[model samples]
Target: MAITIKHHIPGRVRFSLAVLKQYRDLEDWIKQSLIAIQGIKQVRVNSHAGSIAIEYDAQILTEETIKQRVAALDFEQGEAKETEHQYTRGDVAMNAIGTLAAVLLPSRWGAMTTATLIAPTLIEGVNELKDKRLSVEVLDAIAVGLSAWRGDYSTAMMTQSLISFGEYMEQRTSRNSDQLLAELMQPAETMVWKLNDNQSVQVHSSSLIEGDLIELKPGDAIPIDGTIIKGAALINQSALTGENVPVRREEDAVIYSGTSVHEGNILVRVDKVGSEATTAKIAQLIYDSLSSKSEIQQVTQDMANRRVKITLGIGAAVFALTQDVNRLASVFLVDYSCALKLSTPVTFKSIMYRAAQNGILLKGGSAIEKLGQIDTCVFDKTGTLTYGDMQVTDVVPLDGTNDARGLLAIAASVEEHSNHPLSQAIVNAAQDNQLPHIAHGEVEYIIAHGLKSTLNQHCLNMGSRHFLEEHENVDFSPFEAEIKALEQQGRHLIFIAHQKRLIGMIGLRDQLREDVVDTLSQLRASGIKQLIMISGDSQYKAQMLGDELALDKVYAQATPESKSRIIEQLKQAGHKVMFVGDGVNDAPALTQADVGIAMQNGTELARQAADVVLLKDQLYAVAEARTLANIAMKLINSNIKLTEYINSGIMLAAALGWLTPATSALLHNGTTIGILARSLAAKHAK
Candidate 1:
């Protein structure tokens, strides 16, 4: 096979192979082979696109070496190497045709036809026995083989047909569910404009590197985290911060990947690129999580294995008691492996699909199971509970130089040039009130302190109170009582000065999300025993918000490390904790909690560590996930009971000769199919 290099960076490369489009079956074989090679960390093959993305250790194997290895691979050899044990629809259809032919043919021909149809099952059973395992395959083989040995050709063919069809359905359901999740988790590849030799060049995002200058125009998604070096734009950070409105980003402003440019254009110097980008890391985490099994899956698998042994033991007992091959054949037909092993994961996958449709991405079955059991829900204050965007709430003209609207207009006119959150809030407030702009001299931005300019031949300053009162020698003692009152209300005050005198102040605060109260109430109603909040804010502000939300506990002034400690403490106290957060600082806590849910606008690190990531900017998604998980668990348990009880009843009836081999096979397979249907339908339940 010839491979074409699609793109390459330091540690990652993508290749296109036209042969893969024709031979779709080669996808898994190629992926498996590439992943087994040294230094290859991950391989994603898209046969439809004829493309493969490989993330490797660049130090160990260069991109050139990987391409050479790919080119050396033989598709013919790979096709022969791929061996699948599961039955396909064509296999089941052929078996059904064979059963029909056995019944229509003469007795001698029917016996031969039955023997041929049952050969594969018998061989699989022998292989399992050689491997020292009494699997369901072995049970199936014994039942069909005994029926054939007893000269019951029709019964044997029918039994083989039922088993093959059941296996086909089970495999098909599992495969489809997995494919749905894969489609949902796959991230779209992006192309960006890189500045080359002072000219704009379009290239794959994978080819980008740190310090490369990338240009983003209106409606373009920022592909790499970087600092804006030129131009300006209204960037929508809703995907990262859950703020519905777009904010302006100017020169020297830091911009993160995953956010999009709502308007304007800017040149960003890439700080993180390729696999190091937050979105890329998150994509890797999601792929890794797909294969993880939950505790319920493990338990059901163990139960299925144990039941296979029990079925074999019962078959032996029935044969020894009456030396009746017919009874033994019927007894072996009722093994409880198919339903038990397949239904739990099907249910989990179904629920995961439901969660995804509702804007929640459940990483794996383990996340669903753990989320269902969480008793304590802990929330981070800033981005999780609040909108994470400051808005102007009060505008007090302290010196009577301007009314509220006039003070806001003066502040907005100067702050409009800045990209700070507070300045944006003031500008937005002024825009909302249709305030007229007040022209001023060239505004001097003093880094972290404030802004300075000449307004009407007088000095104007806007920044923190310390920047005015201490740095500029402005008098704020006269407004001490009024400032204290606003401070007590948990508002951030921005001091505005004219001619070196305190003129007015703007009080801004990050407002709580509109759905937060309803979300918290739903959490409490859904069996969350303790609703707690952790914040980096002062104790007073934290407690006030906690009280308003009726939370059980509040931990204020929490550091990143302290946040993890709190989760550890709650877990040690016998509570299953679930932490909801969206900042890079919340990564440790997200990892420490029993279940970590990242909001839609969460930082990449937070999303990488979280078990569940909400794709919508809604706090109620937490409660919705919990509800879905609870329903999934209930469905799984019921299916397990249905499988065990129904299979046991069928086996008893077969042992007592109340049912023939054909009838026993029909009932057992029907029960398995019914249980599987119930499991797959979990998304629709409640």
Candidate 2:
């Protein structure tokens, strides 16, 4: 279906409406001149630009004929919304009356479409500013004025409102343009792209600055790639990168050019211009990232059938009511969007600011809300639940000659140059007690194991069993039984020997988080009943930690993709899941979960992977955010219900004619004002 778009509103119509609305007495003059003008849909006499575009049916009217008539007509512009006529030759009110008295003249019907406005010009002389609150009042007064004349106020008001609203939009558009121009300007490049069928599409325009509108529809490349201005377009931004879900282009959401709008229409506003918006550049970042579908998170692929019914029902309801064009247009004013669009986004923005102020940065409000609903908390064992630092949990000496501290000091001296966590832990332990630690010469880290070096001239070795036994002169016989027993008990052992002679063993294990036990109990008590632990560690280690923390499940030796798959499995079972990790490997699972939590102390890559970043290094922050989001959502729903209850009563009374237009306007508009005030009050509410 083709959509009708009016290019712009006329300048004269804007100026005239401005003056006439300011001076009330000039209303008669407008009525007299417009009444006799037959077949005219709009009577606009702009005072500033003095230019107007007359719109009428081509079946009964021609553009040229109407233009000639409009040129011949004479009308005055005055204010009507506020301020009395004070400089009308000592009889300002009388002059205003005379001005409006002329509008009482007989007229023919003419359809006039308004023109685009220059905001700074229009507002220069506007008497009073009317936001959403006062706009309802002005509309109500106009409605009452028409109904009292025993007239069809709906049609008349709709026509005037359409023109007036168009003018108002033009003002906003101009202001937006001005603001954009002030920031940056990129002249539009007229590039003709060759299509598959030898058909070339040309982009021809003026300034192609950032934040300019780009129109797109189904099966179209969201023109110039931008944040969404309108429509819930499901976009395939994949050509620009690897993402599992299609990004939905709606208000506050973004989309890019070369991305196909699969099913819905879109109006995208450019955010980045020129080289920065190159499709290739966007595609590279998207593809280059080792991002994959977090196999762990589930999908809603089966919900299409249920959605089909609701979609049809909603479309039918909207169509049936649109038959009456005036009432259909009225929906734009009393849109369900007032709360959903205005209040909700504003609330999200405010909530984000609050989070930021508390040393947390939530990517967006959607993340916060999603995070609050997480029922299952999945954590990566290393760097997350575990400190990733391996400590000397046990030290078994062979022949009772090598002491734990002496063996560790020797091992740490050999492994001092190593970057491994276990090696650092040994060094830290020695340093903590102020042990006189000194490297006994050069060292080499054996790949897949520990270090090899000459400590005090005996060619010492500190590594796995196989690595230590490789030394030609060392005898593994003495410590063989002891090492085997420790390895059997699932202890990570680093064998230390001097030229094949058994010296001592340093056994290290990853330590758990200090608050892991407390936090796990709290999560279970907080309705997150299903807790899971995933780790790159051995099954024995994972089970040990899981049993200690009382986790419901534990998966060991799982890669990032495997972790994501586990999340998907749980999600498929209809459980809302949350994944927490602090590594480059955890990005997929982080993106996969219903919510992803990034610890502030995590890697930069991991920070970008997770949805919610925990500040203050506490799990309780996650709990607090969930509670806060619950509060925000509860307040939002309550506000919506209240608005509906109040507005329904007012409009229902108006429809019944139990309240005349004036009283109805007062009641309806008064309610709108009250609701606006109430919405603002939420900013201060708990």
Candidate 3:
């Protein structure tokens, strides 16, 4: 094999198109061989790119030798493109052929054929023993060897065939998860419209470069991160923000990749291209998450490794005490290693898939387990508990008319065309109540205050209490107590006056999420003993909200760093804290908590820092996620328990001479299948 040297620097060489069709696993074989040569530091193979990058000590090995080693790599190809997951078509076909021959041939011929077929398994087992390790492969080889020694070649062949198939199934299940993520995040190939000299031209997205002016119409995905140069539109940023609503974007407003234009058209100047885009960074984060071990995964692997030595020791003792080959083989065949190793990863991936379907993105199995263990849950006030938008809560008429609805109608008409959240809330409320549109004369917006308009040639003034009392000089001494009561309830008031006299006051407040109270009650009922609310709002407002929601603790006017400190204090007090937030300011606190759950409408930084994301944008999803975690962990424990108990029972039966090598093998394989089926069938229980 010849390789093209793509680039060379001191102590490094990169080879392009380094893979061969006949030996897809050639890269691994090359890496294993080359790294053994005295000076190599690291070997990285990107099978997708068909390239290899190697770093070595220049002093110990010359560049020419490295190149020659890669080119002169010669060995019989045993398998095609071996990976942590490479049970290829060739391996499957070989197993099928071996099993057919063993089943159809005479005893002597079948024994010989089965022995030849299991040659690789035996060789791998020998290698494992030489390296001082007890592998499932070793146990499997022992079982097959014992059966063949007894002239039961058909049983040996069937056991070995089933073992290979089982391994292939486990590898396939694990790899499917990685593949699903890749597919979901994979970039689509399409043509983008570029604007040059105010003319539109279509070009492939790959051809798009930085600073290119691109035209986007409704329903087109934004291809680059940039500011809008012309036009205006509503952008659906669900892919980035995880929110379902379409946000309005005007000229000079920034837009990002993976977000789609919902309405109108715009010309945007690209600021970042390809992998530099924010969405690409998110994809990279997801890929990086796959390599990280969660606490449970780490503990499970460690326990399995320890169990291997114990199982091997017990098998040896059983053989010594029994002096029966079939009984000894049974002891070797049934063990906890296979079920422990395979079930954990498979269950984790199953939960991840289920979470995705429910609009929650759990980064890994570790997050799921941690979520289940959380005993204290902390929530951010604004945009987390409340809707983050103001809504009209009350209307009081004081101008002797006592018609609150008419006053509200007047206010809604005056602010109908405004873009402010407060104004939008008022309009939305009026529409919800089926209020008719009231026509008015040319409207005037007073900066930092209110609006002015004329209905039937009479002046209408609507604004703040300060704007009405000081600016318009309206007397409200009779209603001072009423005003004070609303203020104490954390209400925001907008005063409306007609012909320079007070007519009414519109009271608005941040509405809490419809299911927030129920969700909090559920969390408390689920053993989360401490429910705390942290916010940057004023102490008075925070207290009002706390009393309303019946929270156990409240921290008002807290900064991002202060929130982090609070989380630390909670941890020091022996609480496993889970923080729920949806802002950039909450990123630090989110990272500080034992588990960070970000809302769907949260900023990119917050979502990236969070271990779990509520893609459905509902707070109740938090409780649902926690419930799912509990179910998954319970299932894992059940699988481990059932496997150990069943294996123990079979070992006892074999010791009593009630089971032969063939029957023991059948029982062992059947138990493994049963455990896996139960783990896979696990689903979220309410």
User: How much lDDT does each candidate structure score?
Assistant: 0.79, 0.50, 0.74
- Candidate 2 per-residue C-alpha lDDT over 223-243 given as tens digits, one digit per residue, 9 for 90 to 100: 364677666766665544656
Model 2 C-alpha RMSD vs. true structure (Å) is 19.9
* Candidate 3: tens digits of C-alpha lDDT, residues 1-686: 65788989989998875455445555555554445444566666666676778887787566676786666556463224445435755676787788788889887788778888887777777877898877776776777777777787777877777677667666555445554444333344446778878656778876888899987764455767899998888886655555655799999999987676655668898997654455433444344445456677777777777767766787778778877777777676676677777777777777876777788778888788899899999999867898756788998888776487777777787776443446767887887888777778766555445677888788888877666778888788878898888878798677888888888888889878999988998898777989999976557878889988999999986777789999999999999999999765677788889999988766554665688988776899898888788878888888888877888898778767788877887888778877776666553323
Clash pairs (backbone) in predicted model 1: 240-601
Residue-wise C-alpha lDDT for candidate 1, range 101-178, written one tens digit per residue: 787998899987787878998998898899998778888888788878878787788878878876776656555554
| lDDT value, residue 587 of candidate 1 | 68
Candidate 2 weakest lDDT stretch, 10 residues = 109-118
TM-score of each: 0.71, 0.47, 0.65
Q: Order of all candidates by lDDT, from best down to worst? A: 1, 3, 2
TM-score of model number 3: 0.65
Give RMSD (Å) of candidate 3 vs. truth. 12.4
lDDT of 3: 0.74
